[model samples]
Target: MSSTALRRSLLAASAVLVTAGVWLAAGTASAGTLTGTLYRDTDTPVARWLAANPGDSRAAQISSRIASQPATRWLSNFNVGTIESEVAGYVGAATRAGQVPALTVYGIPNRDCGGASAGGAPDLATYQTWVNGIARGLAGRTTLIMLEPDSIALQTCLSAGEITARDQALATATRTLKAAGAKVYLDGGHSAWNAAAEQARRLANAGVADGDGFYTNASNFQSTANESAFGRSVLSALSGRGINGKRQVIDTSRNGGAAGDWCGDDNTDRRIGRYPTLDTGDANIDAYLWIKPPGEADGCAYPAGSFQPSLAASLATGAANPPTTTPPATPPTTPPTTPPTTPPTTPPTNPPTGACGATYATSSSWQGGFQGQITVKAGTGAVNGWAVSWTLASGQSINQVWGGVLSVSGSTVTVRNAAWNGSLQPGATAEFGFIANGPAGTSSLSCSA
Candidate 1:
């Protein structure tokens, strides 16, 4: 190949690698490569949803899509008496599985600015005592601790004195967790909410110098690319302040789709993001973790942290866009806001070959779910009706299907043409999209009428 062709090919390959989290610059060592498998909690919210709603339309989708992925286990309440044992049991399970447990320590006093996720320890002293129990449970094994979700970032309600007190408490909590052999990531707000410089300074106040690093997008829905880039900027800022070598993680729990309201059930555009893993190609990014379990309310729709299967199903529709890193060229601004119930007006680029033909593609991918579209085309002859079938992977299921009728019997899923779409001229095509539960599955499609 010519040198130019080689360079272009190399660049294309590089872009693909970068999107999978292998973003490279100069001498930055990737964070997740050295770690063990990130832990998967058996009792995650989606797990419970599967148990209770097996007969529900979205149960299978939620089971294979969201519930199968590992999410951070947040210790939000301050029941000191059981905190240690509770943590110990979780850690033990992770140890048995030989996976690295990811824990979120959220009992900070006045968490969430007293908003939907309000309530923490009564005071800093109680918070410390509570953290100590969490530490004891760790017992010197390696774990990832997201010290607090918004303890520093969402501090508008606090006075200067109050912010200072919270800062000190976080510093103490970091030390306690680290001493117990945990890799503690102090909160670094998120890219959308705080400027890199400001959050770096805030993290400094919260003792980023002593922690493993800082984490971003915990319970917030910012794209992983945006959050990971923000983390690099924060690290650079931290280095300027004489604190260096800090790695970061992003909560890719529910940031799929567009950047809109980060709370409640009203937003249909929200989707789950990348699954948890430390293998981010970017050395500065430790992992893209699902810190906030999908389907749980952010205080707007249901009580804070209430898991809803229907909500999970909606978010899972991004194929539950599997929280991939780089999104394809900018998504059309208006497309996500509108439901995809209407078939696309455009014709298929692929001409019809047989009486029926079908194709599937992932429209956009994010943490928990992905959006997929299937195009049905008439081959050499006009077709009055058609059906397409494929076997879903173990965890693959459908949430909302449009432009077609959907049914699942065991792993095999079949979609038949909708009323308007069933009638197609030869070589004409009709398309449909749906929110799927898991990653885009193998495309061994069979079409018939």
Candidate 2:
């Protein structure tokens, strides 16, 4: 062979070897890398239901849909004697599966503010010991830790000294969880609760710098868009206060569509939201998660904590976008000269021109009960107050509502603004939710303001 030919052949062989080596490395990384949020793959309520009722079509459907989805495992039972072993077991299983485990370390003192889902360590010392055990069980494995859901958000419910102690406990817990190779996310209340600045300040005070970032909409029914926007605002505020590099994850489990009244029962209108993803496009946003498992009770349908199979099945099988029928235009009601002490049973006839408009949806339903939500949009002008009215289909009756004053007379229901949520500027929106009892679900609802 000529010298030139020999040289060319040698160069081509070298190039081929390098290219093959690159391809092999790329394939190895792709196979071994943990790319997305981890699916714990543990048995949940839906799984248990499916196992017991193999012949039930509804249970089967729900099982099939959520069996593979990722959910946060809660570690809120302070009384459980074997917490360390349980945490270790969960982390070990997740590590073997090549996934990260997400846990909620809920048991802070004064937890849930004595609400239905209330109970925590009797004192701060006990809480610290419990958290230390959790950290010890993690054993330096990569895990996701969602701190107490309402711990920082509901600080106002505590006395001054209690708030100080809560802050110290949270800080200690944050440091402990992080030292064990866990990514800790502090709680930031939903968009509707705290203003961005106030929430950011509270997070900073709770030692957010010791963890990965903050989480929003934990067990709440706010839309992903709204939560994301709120998350950004809070992050920006944190940044302004010199707290940088903080990332956020949102609870998209039940916020499939629009925002709903957080305090309503039977809200079956909620559908499963965006699947968990690490590549959220936004730099500061980490993942969208089912922090609150979809099928679990939200304290309303089944005694605040008990699982409701009917409600769970409804949520699992429902459509993300249920068909909505626009109600016929009703003449605007006259502005009340004085705000009524009670929500009027009858809707006003003349609402101010461009006062507000509303859209309603049945969030979820079971055999004899259903949940409903209303979103009132402020018109071109500011709205000092507003009222919405809707007539239920036969057999439906409003039982309880939150975020608004609800007055029901037979099938017709009138909802007036609650004291705190009554005012809105142009383009602003106010949402309220309620639960009703009926056999026929709220398939079609007409709402007008």
Candidate 3:
């Protein structure tokens, strides 16, 4: 596909990319990143519930928020007759919408290690036949295939022979899907799971080197910051094993609380993390995806994979948190509290932008390169799109950028609104960040919309 088409497809592909939630720390993103849009099914379980229960009090808010968001669709069933046409129809819709459809191939035998999400094709031959249906359905369309969640990470249940068979199956499946123009990401669990080196070894054994990259935090609630760091660590370890230029995608759904609670009940306060987009400024991360759709039960709360409206409502409203304070009725007096000997230092802030102009701020600096961000705000009138440009100082060139699409001509660099972030109401603001080579430099920034 052409670059323009790919950009259009990636507009809302991953989570809004600035890498970190606040760009508070330097990222390990490399240049030449993959960008695209994610497929949003209008037929989610949330949508079905809303259609049937319009009278419910929480329906409207849920419709406005949860129902409209893009989510991953799992192909865990093995219907031989209709599977090809069913997936072909899905591919056709995504093609018409110009978005990259993500399908989670979650039907590995002994899936979830006979845990809540168990069952797959009966054997290796049956699974390969099932995979052949998926490839034909893809019809060589550009697609993102999340090979198997927990397939690589949760391999403890398999015997030595089972492990080798499963890994070989995954490698063959990766090859098959890639042959159909699909970008495949094998599972890498989350930051809280396997250590980087161990995960890297597992990934290499499973043929991650031949695929696009690997995914992390599938259906878990580790913070994106932690996931990004862990992904880079995994990528670094993979590189040491001769797997170079690999990227990562993170699951941001149901993790907005930034906590690590892993369930779908009301007690485990969680919310939607970030919207799907490919503008993550981190070079190593491809996008933030909603791998596990919110509102779906995690088996602990209800039957696994069923949509629960009350749970969805809880996520939408978030946990009702009160301000931190000691309750007068039960103040503890058993132990004395001690304060830190050294005071905490204040952090740097980004300069506010005015009208069409923008200001660049360096968040942190290292030996040769520094991380920087550009804050852009709309002027008095509403605008559909915006662009910011500046001249690169000698020995200063950007390596990667997120939150905007970047273009350059010699010493001049320009970044424009991505497909999803371009339209702005009057005075509305957006920001894009980049990691540049050499020392950070200052230059007058001119922006227009």
Candidate 4:
């Protein structure tokens, strides 16, 4: 059949699938079925960037804030011959480690509307085959599948016939992934993109009844609270259509309370959101995830997919910084007590005075790397901010640090307070840690704040 003729036939077939109620009767699954914590893969884009550019001004801060957190791994390309094996490897490793693996399936035909991430299977049949490969790769393991980012939300870009075909493709993919023990979440776009009722209708057309639920703010910067409300509204619409027992998740990676210019390269308001948690209190909301890894350029500042250290730093420090304030409820001075009847003894020597003090400790050690922490204590008065500097004697180099902004020069490492962790009242303390490459032994580390 000619391509056009075949597509016409498929659209007709999909129309029948939509009206026949085949997808509606499919069993419902809850996002709560997902158990255990999400995994943080050791090798991520930010991790690689930190290793390559240790000298970048924001390297330490970005690495420290992001490396330990869990983010989604995208499996968008379907052309690679080893795609199946790659999926199996990632899912299998995650399962064995007692962590949940989140994967994004973005290989729908005409993906991304021919924009920055514009590539996918050329036709529905090829796309189905690729999705089947992804299913086989799952090997019946529990996984989180973000079906597609823009497939449904952007259906307006397609003709009526094309929209029908796209719906069929999404429906097929959702069914296939669900059958393979994956929890599927269709894209509901951000709260700002489509009305709750409208996006819910799109999700229904894309066969959400056969899947777990839908996700909002996939790659956008909508606030968590806003996305939660939006997701519930979408689910409410779905329930009104007799699609109940559905749940949702939001991308909280960069929605640091500010929705900056979506296309600007120098958006410094981007800060990290809450860490992933399944206990979101709302029974309908599953978890807040870092769907779009921070520091990855959003088609500007750098190449669309390249890592921008400064952008990542902004996420690490942006909203996290709060103004320094005196410690709440300082003890009031009392009248001097009368001198004891005993003869006055020599006045005790005063303890050493200093601006701040820090103590270093090693947390864990592996073959070629170790994790260490530093605790900074304020002395005498409140501190607006602090910087701790230390020298590594055993050739140890930091690859990642969290909870502070870090810079390295030769063997000396310096860390400054992040916006969120600064402001220590008198006697209050703050701590930060880092993972570094060195011999598996203690080194002469000194800290001054």
lDDT of each: 0.68, 0.63, 0.68, 0.65
Error of model 4, residue 64, in angstroms = 1.7
State which candidate, 1 or 2, has the greater TM-score. 1
TM-scores for every candidate against the unseen true structure: 0.65, 0.64, 0.64, 0.63
- Per-residue lDDT over 280-389 for candidate 3, one digit per residue giving the tens place of the 0 to 100 score: 77777777778887777664534456577888887778533212221111112232122111111111243234446576776444456655767676777777888999
Question: Better model by lDDT, 3 or 4?
Answer: 3
Error of 4 at 212 (Å): 0.4
10 residues in a row with least lDDT, candidate 3? 1-10
lDDT of 1 by residue, 308-342 (tens): 66788888885643444322122232323222212
Task: Write down the lDDT that model 2 would get.
Answer: 0.63
Give the runs in model 2 whose Cα sits over 4 Å from its true position. 1-34, 320-449
Q: After superposition, how far is residue 189 of candidate 3 from its true place, in Å?
A: 0.4
By descending lDDT, how would the candidates be arranged?
A: 1, 3, 4, 2
Q: In order, how many clashes per candidate?
A: 30, 14, 13, 6
Which parts of model 3 have CA positions greater than 4 angstroms off? 1-32, 318-449
